[model samples]
Target: MVLLKARVPRAVALLGCFVLISSLLTLTTMAQTTVTSGGIGVHILFQTNKWVTPNIHYKAGTGSWTTSPGVAMSASNNSEYPANDGWFQFDSSTATSLEFVFNDGVGVVWDNNNNANYKVSATGTYSVVSKVSDFKTGDLVRPSDGTGYHILFQPITWAKPYIHFNAGSGWTTVPGNAMSPSTYAGKFSAANGWYEYAISSISTVEITFNDGNGVWDSNLNANYVRTSPGTYAFVNQNTATPTTAPSIQGYVNGPGYSVTSASETAGVLTINLAVNTASISTSYGTDLSALVVTVTKTETDSVRVKIVDKNNKRWEVPKSVFTTGTLGTDSSSTSDAVDALYSFNYTQNPFTFQVVRKSDGYTLFDSSGISLVMKDQYLQVSTTLGSDLSVYGIGESTRDNFKMASGDKQTLWARDQGSATPIVNTYGSHPFYLGINSAGQAHGVLLLNSNGMDVTMDSGHLVYQAIGGVLDFNIVVGPTPAKVVSQYTKLIGRPKLMPYWSYGFHQCRWGYGSVDALRTVVSKYKSNNLPLDVIWSDIDYMKSYHDFTLDPTNFPQAKMAIFMDEIHASGQKFVPIIDPGIPDDNNDYAYTKGLSMDIFIKDTSGKPYLGQVWPGPTVFPDFFHPNAKTYWAEQIQLMYKNYSFDGLWIDMNELANFCPGTTCYDNPPFAINNVNSHDAIYNKGISTRRIG
Candidate 1:
């Protein structure tokens, strides 16, 4: 059992247990103490072509077994083993006794010594053979075969198999040299559909195979390492099982809707659409027959086009969550195509609209080629772009470049993955992009829906495929890039002005373990002549990594207050990290108060959802709840009373979760490219269907 202490600011103090364990042991006799030392080594001999690099899965006395496929054994040439026979070696410095098995390292084939396993009670080298009659120890000389390595490849479907290798020298050219079909005797034959490659000048080689293209069969990405010159086979074990591709087809290609009626009120143009029933349905989801399209000129430089079901039964983002500018009322006539800075024109049958700039007559958004698709759980809209157009944003991804490539498909789903993962959704999702045409005119498009989506930019087209919600696009037309950003931020509220001290040099790390350590760090900056304006702390100060609670022993309340005073006297501010997870302890004040206030998110069973974080099991606060702000403010106020911290480092509010398969809602029929279909919907963060 691990006890974690927590305290509310005023008078309440509580003791919590993050985890508990109870074990009962029955012994018949007293245990004996034995001393053990030295190392153990094993030599395995098998047919060379049977396995690539054999793995040794073992457990030393009372220790745990290695993971499946275990550790790879290196090819050995100790002069004591018979030449041409495949030999591999495994060594451990401190394991005196070992119970072990051998595998092909690909997890498919194994040699567990006839299912009994091989055991050793003492240290030193042990030669393992297939049978007792095959055991021998002598200097064996090699037969005068060729002095090179022979590689045999069996491509599952590759039309042109190539070998890329290094022969104790350097690498061959990329994709290397192509191999020809061959019938090598005693090894793989043309009758077995194999391709052969041999390097005669080198006795040892490191090799990988690929098509002339970038696709590779690099031995499951580890490549093949060979030490002896002999016939070997390259078998790809990571080939995907053949199955039907995921259900994302027919989504982009669908029968478009036709405009039945159009009317303009003030600057808002409302168009009623009817589904075209001439073509067959995509069968992805139930297509809403009747839809409403509203085009609101929100600003002189911006316009908001919204598409939704006619009944408005589907979910839409509430105005309280994200506030936008007021709608403009400049247009007076229904036939006025040009409003202020832009014009809206459309084709009525297979309805497609274009937002054209009035100044330069540039088409900012033109959806002419493809039809607009609107389903219950899936919505798609696309616009063509010039070939020389440069696009940026659609971020919350670790992109390789600032400008998006033509083949880039940006998935707009807020995820909890690290920024090091390239081309995947991370943290915040801003479904907005800036496009600069070849002539340098710029415009911005903002998809204001809070749903999972795939924004694909390819083949001179920018497409939006969302799993839910209406297509609430806010287009900002700009004659210049700077004005486009200015108009864009104006619509979505400008960034707040940061404090002046925030611009100054500051220090932050995760390992300032105690209040004294923090003081020492501040002192060191002064001693080293480094100007420090602010200092920050990670979760180390929190009691067992719980939010709003300082560790009593390490970061004592009295000491932390004194340290804060000292830092303030030196004209420095302090900030500490705060995560959203409150330890799910009945005794904990934050958790109890949040529960009473109904602020925590609930599971499918209507109970408070439980997830694992730094503090074992935890409950997340639903920021959408009415009383959530009050509950959160009270906790922060109590914490501030105990320690006078200046600012907070809000973290983990991406609603990150350590628990798996805990979704409270059914997955959408359409899947966005978010690391895979299942993970994108159910395993990323909080479920998209969860109500705040």
Candidate 2:
């Protein structure tokens, strides 16, 4: 797959010379802050050796603190302070005093003045001293033996510090090894007064700190987790009690549901569930008191299970979106459960369900252990996994492994992010995963919901935590991996076969400056005895990167037609990239036509949602709009009339935008593990709350 940010051309067996073009416009912006008169303006200076951005966690008087690790501070250009210092200016017109702390922005290390925050009453510059001595002026302190994973600890008070650790598998003997007094002048070492220990030849280590007499700091018994080979600070020092990490506020497990009534008809089971209100509310949203579950035997190998609020109406994926296979009938008259290729069993109170293979009695999915959480904005469910599990295909992420690791968290929220970034949501969301057991028996599960979610695989379980939508799951059972895939595709419609020539060597790049450059690239490939089947053009062919418009100077209509004739004669094809953002210009035919048809996504104020893209100000076509198909077809045909391209490269369909507007769905109460868990839902994408 070609990512928009960085397109890496695939190496094909047939050698080809592709044209490269330079983009004419580059977007760059500098942030400027303006301070109001009478507002408190305080500049903070901090020093550190680590190459990390400095940040400040600050609040005015008794106000709430800024989001951790707080707002980033800019590198100081002030001549009065040291050149290496980071600067942060606090300007709040209504504020009296400021209480703040400096950090490295990663939440790992901080300069908190020994846990007491810094305070200031007036506008001035204050220097934060985190280290005992400046490393720049003093002799640089290095580890006794540099090659290892190091941990620097500052105990509450200990005569001798020892470390009990494990690198990959086994643990060290008894009280473990003694630690040395640190002379390191790094960010972690400088801020945290040092008692250091090194574990040689290991990339990661799980450790617990202890004194020689057996008083231990095992991170409150949870132990410090594995981290990469680098000098780190042991921030937690609870020698008496086990360490407990902070939990998300107002987030808790549900009391689950109980089946108040159940019935079956024509191989379909419908159950009415009553909410168990015995547990505390999750507080993200009010829990529905009642829910309904429908289980359908869609086919011999497929089962569909859907859960939703019984009384109130809610949004669901439209039935017209995809073609689900026909629901099969069970002629057995004995029980609600039909004996098919798979069996569905359930418990009544604190509901749990299981899908098991009938032949081997192998459980494919079992939710017996975990509680089900369903709310207006949050939903969570989990299934137990077998010991010999090898799961694949919850994408579209760029992962290094085909089989997912045990401790992996995959977020499903489509965004216009590059595939080069691993373990983050990108371009498309596929809530399907295939799992195989030791006996090679495979099964597939598809959570047919479009809500943002984080799917975690850890400790013999697969958990789903969604911020919206129902728990609609489709399971396909197969005794073999290949058969499981076939069964899965049958249920969710098979992919369309591409044109035969598409499999051949295709040359493409962003910077084909003109028609002449494209022709030169094709000629060079032929001269070098390399096979070339298709030529592609990026946004360079468009007029100022506006959709459906050609650059009259570089790719004139007359010249393009002549070039098309030459390429057609050689059985070669041409494809041009088409971005979804329509230029909001009044003179643009496509934009005007779409506007008349009312096919553009609108902002909260009922005006067309204008976003920034290559075309400057743009509006996205609402594909969900009734007349969108007609308007889009007309625009594509108009472009085809100008350039006889063979295929269309739909780029940036993630509906990417350079600037997320004020009315966009920037924040939600429940957060998904979105790209690095730090980015907002509207980051580089349209608002999720918008609809046709």
Candidate 3:
């Protein structure tokens, strides 16, 4: 029996566990139990292509696992591999109160995790479904065909597949001369409907799989590595299960939020509302004593709506990044003072509204189809859109084109998925979208909340589901797309001005080994008369990839400074990547200063959060912290005094960490739970990247 313990105040400590355990025991006795005396059914699932038509067997807790008359797993849907689920049911009459596990017929790889065994009660018809996990990415542990390396790519009908690898020799594509499918005759083949490649060799290697048109899969910090020369197969597979917006197909508005009072003054409309349903709990940080809706006519063509708690304490984007000041009213107390370009009509019961263009009476926005919900941790708002809408500008997604297709669901979660991987949330997050109507006029909507969310563009409707923050939006309407962008930029800050040379050609690469190699690159560019105005460097120039330190042996400070002088003499510049990772070395000046100044983001327990990046184990500066700028500037000055770098290329500000953030906190914010916000360590070899 497990003893339930509780930590409580001294006065209640003695009675806490007793009261809770007694209540639980009483509840268990009242629960119903089924009885099945004849037989129980057992079901199991495994990757079809992983095991070559191997028979499957099971073992009860009372006896050794048996395979005498094992059943064969069918190869149906083998194309799905890891997600390919096949099941078999068997009659079990002998074992009651049975605990069992599945095994491959050969007795090698068994599905067994502590306490994960399935149990059977000798009650009525009973069945269990279990999935056998696939082998790790470069592992030889399994019932296998003895191939050294197993490589497979999610099959795409459009392009031919190939690999670019560093196998002792410098990086090179497999069928080096030409990529004609027939040229790589012996190398390419298909396994269970997936494009696969297998090789048996030993070396300190790195690889990435690519299709013909520069599409590739390479996790920035990790790649497939095999040391011992032996046969292995890449058992892992990629599935293009794009995330869809959370379904609200049959949902109905909970209750009609009534408008208790309203007033219009100086082109601003303010409404005081009372939630008609007490069951609707929208308050997060405080009690929902009241609700307020504020609408302002910001421009002749655009209006803004903001909903929030009556206390006026809702969270919003910091003023540092959002610099657009509010527009003051010209007159007082009259609807006629508002913009004449658009008109708004709203219903008081359940609170719905429609905005129409005054010239042609075209409906710019309608919210009657779906209900608006704003909660402490959740917010939902939907608007009807025109059928021929052309949408763009949800920043930082790798797409062949800028326009978002109809029915495309984009998630606003910043991630570290390196550039070139399409259909996944990459670096930055901008919860703003521009839509052009059939009449060639465009309008932009900006959801000002910074929380993660899924914004779906359903056929003629746009839905937003955010995890937290107030439901605030600034709308812009323009007759042209360019004008719409200009208005949107006014709400958010305008882009930073760039230097003249920055507009010229800039060349960058990851592995420019040493000072000599960099010089050679410049020499080649000059000899060929290529217009290279600036030469950039990746992490290789840093000592052990630690930021703010040059590799003494490869890029000696004296020699590097001399090289930079030579480049400057020719009217050129040198730039280096400055990652936001500070090594946790006690003697390291940058880290020590950050720690002393309390500048690093803290874990749940309030200690500085540690993550693994280029510098093995490092801490990240909390740019949100008040002292961050000072600390960052001090660190940059140290490097500037020594290297005299012309410019710094800021990267990895997405707070990319090899160590998963979910595991960093002892108690994480519940808002991050449902959102696809964290990643797992690459050593685990599970595709833990969250595409949603």
Query: Which candidate gets the maximum lDDT versus the true structure?
Result: 2
Candidate 2, residue 18: lDDT? 45
- For each candidate in the order shown, give its overall lDDT on alpha carbons: 0.69, 0.70, 0.58
lDDT of 1 by residue, 259-352 (tens): 9999987767999999998883665676779899888777678878888899767776666554443323222333234546898888898889
**Candidate 2 wrong stretches, greater than 4 Å:** 1-251, 323-339, 662-665, 688-692
Q: Ten residues in a row with the worst lDDT in model 3? A: 20-29
TM-score of each: 0.66, 0.65, 0.61
Candidate 3 global CA lDDT score: 0.58
Give the true-structure RMSD of model 3.
Answer: 23.7
TM-score preference between candidates 1 and 3, better one: 1
| Ranking of models by TM-score | 1, 2, 3
Give the alpha carbon lDDT tens digit for every residue of 1-692 in model 3: 11111111111212112211110011111112222234444323332223444455656546776654355554432111122233233444455444545455455555443336555544333323234555445554333354454445433321344666666777774422112222111112232223555545455566665544444445443666656544334422343433333343322354436788999777788988776675563332222446787877777767777777776587777666554443222212223434457787788987877777776676767777666766555566778887777778765554555677666556666666543234545667788888887888877888778766666677577777665678777777665889887877766657567666765666665546788767866776776666677777778789888888889998999989999899999998888778788898887888889999998877656777767787888888878788998988887788877767777777666656677623312122223212222222222111123211
Q: How well is each residue in 596-657 modelled by candidate 2, as lDDT tens digits?
A: 99989997678898888888999999887889989988988988898788888777777788
Worst 10 residues of 1 by lDDT: 20-29
Listed per model in order, the count of residue pairs whose N, CA or C atoms clash below 3 Å is 0, 5, 14
Ranked by lDDT, top first: 2, 1, 3
Native-referenced Cα lDDT, model 1 = 0.69
